[model samples]
Target: MYIPAHFAAGPDVIRDLLTRPSAANLVTMTSQGLLATFLPLIYDPSAGEHGALQGHLARTNSQWSEPAIGESLVIVQGADAYISPSWYASKAEHGRVVPTWNYSTAHVYGKLAVHEDPAWLGNHVRQLTNLNEADSERPWSVDDAPERYVSGQLRAIVGIELVITRIEAKAKLSQNRPDKDIDGVVAGLDAQGHSEIAADVARARLGS
Candidate 1:
């Protein structure tokens, strides 16, 4: 998260990115070494001062059993696109511009808490399911399966709750570039079928 002043993201932006459709990389340090897992997380902004995140991992995953030393990190990544130097107005003016990347990302640091109770795990899974399935024509639920089957499935996984301590977010969407150069970036990205990144760049430009 090497965020320059102009690229620093506020709390609202960070929370929005965390709640979006992004997979988070959960990293923890143990006596043996650093371990990581990729999973989807649900952010509950009302749960704590900074916020809380809920996720689950397979019981066979050893990373969950190890003691989380001090703080753990969860990285949420958003749309990204490469910005070619040819898209910058300065490139033709003085050849001063170089290629770079434009992207949005957030790092959440928190204290890890593990839950093994079947009821708790079931509730977590249900919430996660609903959140992801909301946009579908027919949503699926944990209760859709047989009671015994659902219980067995829950038993095979462990629930994780991270009480957030702090968050660092960055949106490197060409904020440092001139207006014409940013416009070129948006146009180039959109032409390259990266509408998400182009939209983000446009939004950042309007915000600036």
Candidate 2:
């Protein structure tokens, strides 16, 4: 992650990236080579020194069975959008502005831990389900299925935990732009329906 100091994410942004309901790409080095999986993860702040990421993989996914060599990584990203020079007030003033991108992301590195116990898997799945389904009109739960069927489904997957060692995150949300330019960017992004990244850029501007 090539993060300029001005583009570095604040602690609040990092916390949101971790705690928000989302998915990340988990990458690990194996004896064969590098393997990756996009997984829905939850931040477990109580798990370790720096906490851990909890998720699961299907039993058939070879990546889960393979022993990860050295440190593993999980890439978490928030909203990203294209920023046109046309959106910058400076573009009209000097015609020197160029197009760019605005985004927030984190590189989480940690040791991998696998769990086969049905009890742990059951608890993990329930937490994950609740987190994602919280906004739904009628949320689903593990208990919604037959006990035997749920147990069988759990048996078909393996739980994975990434005990965090470190995290490097960046928020390239036009924090370096001047106030007038940033205002233009926010308005342009909102008009384009990129509300999330637009808000991120607006927040970054205020933070700066």
Candidate 3:
């Protein structure tokens, strides 16, 4: 979350981060303290215009059951890579630098509301299921399942709608480093075959 202006991500970056159509780490605080769960997330940037986010959690998961409805954090993590100190041109000249992580992360702080309506819950699950299966060679569909069985399963979980009050996003992709250092780091990561990290570094370079 400590994002330098040079490393700061824009709205396009934030939208792209969630558009990965992936699950996100959600954290909520309760009387019991902090609870975190990985849940598939759908963000409507338009929702923020009205001050809200809509998502759901399984009722079976106690993370949503706490009587307290405080602000929650939804984290979407994108590609990340390790930047070795050795990759920094400065490392050879000054030897004052240490290794760092290059990554993209978004934080959504919002109001949490839990819903139990069967219709709403069913839609939530169905959308999530579709999103998860969208990229599969043979994507699965909720309609593919027996209605009675799927309905029973939906009853077992909880649906939540979070109204996002704020969103902070940062791509720590070595913007703090000199161009030569960044090139060296990207080259090192790519050469090492750390494809994920390398991809992130590449994206960061673009964003920066």
Q: How far is candidate 2 from the true structure (C-alpha RMSD, Å)?
A: 0.9
User: Taking the tens digit of each residue's C-alpha lDDT, what string does model 3 give over 86-152?
Assistant: 9888988989999888888888888887889999888877777777788899998999999999988
Question: What TM value does model 3 have?
Answer: 0.86
**What do the candidate models score in CA lDDT, each in turn?**
0.88, 0.95, 0.78
Q: List the candidate numbers ranked by lDDT, top first.
A: 2, 1, 3
lDDT tens readout by residue for model 1, 90-119 = 888999878898888988999999999988
Q: Kindly give the stretch of ten consecutive residues in candidate 3 with the minimal lDDT sum.
A: 45-54
Clashing pairs in 1: none
The TM-scores, one per candidate, come to 0.94, 0.98, 0.86
Ranking under TM-score, best-scoring first?
Answer: 2, 1, 3
Give candidate 2 regions above 4 Å deviation. Answer: none
Best by lDDT: 2
lDDT of 3: 0.78
Error of 2 at 177 (Å): 0.5
lDDT score for candidate 1 against the true structure: 0.88
lDDT of 1 at 26: 96
